[model samples]
Target: MKIYFKTFIAIIFGVSLLGCDPAEKQNKNEEFPILGRKQFVERTVNGETVVDTIDHTIPDFRLVNQDSIWVTPKSFENKVYVADFFFTSCPTICPTMKKEMLRVYNAYKNNNSVAIISHTIDPKHDTVALLKDFAQRLDVEAPKWNFVTGNKEEIYELGQKGYMVTAMEDENEEGGYIHSGAFILVDKEKHVRGVYDGTNSNDVDRLIKDIDRLLATYNEPKTKS
Candidate 1:
């Protein structure tokens, strides 16, 4: 189940400003087709194809965690992970997304190998302190699950362009900003193996299965600490 909207007109406007190709945008209300649990290979610069992959490849990104610590792609080297976008003040889909993430956090708390990344769409408003409080309210523990905020432009770029995810803001239309609640599963070798709906429990369960499959098939990609 996907979270709903008060208004999506502003989101559509933002998409238009970005010159979205109608063809590539996701259907009005359809999830992307994802194969269940398969170990596909991901070709990388290291000349090795990390086994068990799906849709996307990792691109270098820089962000800050809830504690305001600098974080980057290198932070998760060799780790299998899940990530989503939301705002602390969001009254619509964000609540459901965060609540769902809490479930994921509880389910995988004992598993250090799995990690969660939450990025705030409204970076200016969602400061470290705010995010910290929000996480506490949700009871998300530290280290394993990290809430992040960074440069607004960079955040939008990473969400929209780099990750091929949807994110935009438009004051003229309806909703101030819009984003997807998809939880992306990235294999250790840096290939995005699966994308699940953080708002949908079923998709998230499948995400867990796929994560286990990726772990079983591909050794973590090595990185410098």
Candidate 2:
């Protein structure tokens, strides 16, 4: 009877160990979709030649930030960033999006590796001075969070072709321009790792969780020096 009981306890212990495995837990993180180009020819692996799938990345852009500084893709080099479109005068979904973005800002306020880039769809009205005032009103500091504005056509092209979001003018729309209420998650390599609805609390919660996961990918296990 003692031998049989000991074997049963041992089996239970093994099962519990398996259930608590960290690798298993980590594997449960939902993999965020990569938006943009599917693949590209990297280089010839050998004389035999090889092609590699391309991870679509946010294209290079130059726009003036709240501080009246020219912000470019290089500004976010080796950093993960959240991106969205909003104008200072927006009266509809932009307010909700900004509220949700504040949640993201609070989460990574002190983390230098994280940043947020908000572009203005109505660049004509959202000039650098106007953006600066808007950022101040929102209690956001420059460099960490940038409210950028530039050529309307360029910004629109970036919204559609670069970030895969909508940004266009419409007379019937409440805000005058129609833009997506999405908060885009970009990795250190400029790749769009995830897209969350900026107006939904639940989606923003997932965005926060996924940001941690995305950061984990960069925190590779260090080797003993």
Candidate 3:
């Protein structure tokens, strides 16, 4: 009787180890999904290539430019751009941010290969007229530099979703909206290559080097082996 009881106890233990409850195993298996794509490069904060996400298609957006021109994703389809998120009314870091961008604008103003997009976080107060005025103050030439404003929700979503930049309204802060001061370097294919501190010349210098490297890569002709 003891031998028979021991055999039955071992069998029960083995089955329990495999699945104490079959229902829980099925629920856990359903939660995991396979990684689908690896289209764009994702680098570490220190600028090392680590893992890349598969979605390479650039996100779509629509807004009116400084010239009151309706601009869409296609406007930048074949060009690289250093993008930043800010509002004209910002009194803290925005002026410094704009100064850094001015250097970049001066650097690439003559080159038709690259562009700049300064998107406003506060679209309600920053109308097309207001954006136009802001562009003029910064000497943002038409077709080269664009100051854009649109539906508030859309622009905010672009910050969090598209650019992976942060822009959120903080009722507790002095200014309603808070945003990062990084300049995002994007390729012609619409993939973000690097992000740099707009306030730091050293970071911007590195960003410039990367941008030049990327442009050269696209322009270079393939040599026959």
Q: Model 2, stretches more than 4 Å misplaced? A: 1-29, 42-47, 222-225
lDDT (Cα atoms) of all candidates against the true structure:
0.75, 0.89, 0.81
TM-score of each: 0.70, 0.84, 0.74
Q: Put down candidate 2 lDDT per residue, 37-146, tens digits, no spaces.
A: 78777577556777788888788899999898999999998789999998888988889999999999989999998999999999888888999888899899879999
Candidate 1, residues 112-175, lDDT tens digits: the string is 7788888888888889999889888887756678899988988888877555678777565234
Which has the greatest TM-score? Answer: 2
Q: Indicate the residue-level lDDT of 167 in model 2.
A: 89
Task: Specify the highest-lDDT model's number.
Answer: 2
* Candidate 1: C-alpha RMSD after superposition: 15.4
Ranking by lDDT: 2, 3, 1
lDDT, candidate 2, residue 130? Answer: 91
Worst 10 residues of 2 by lDDT: 42-51
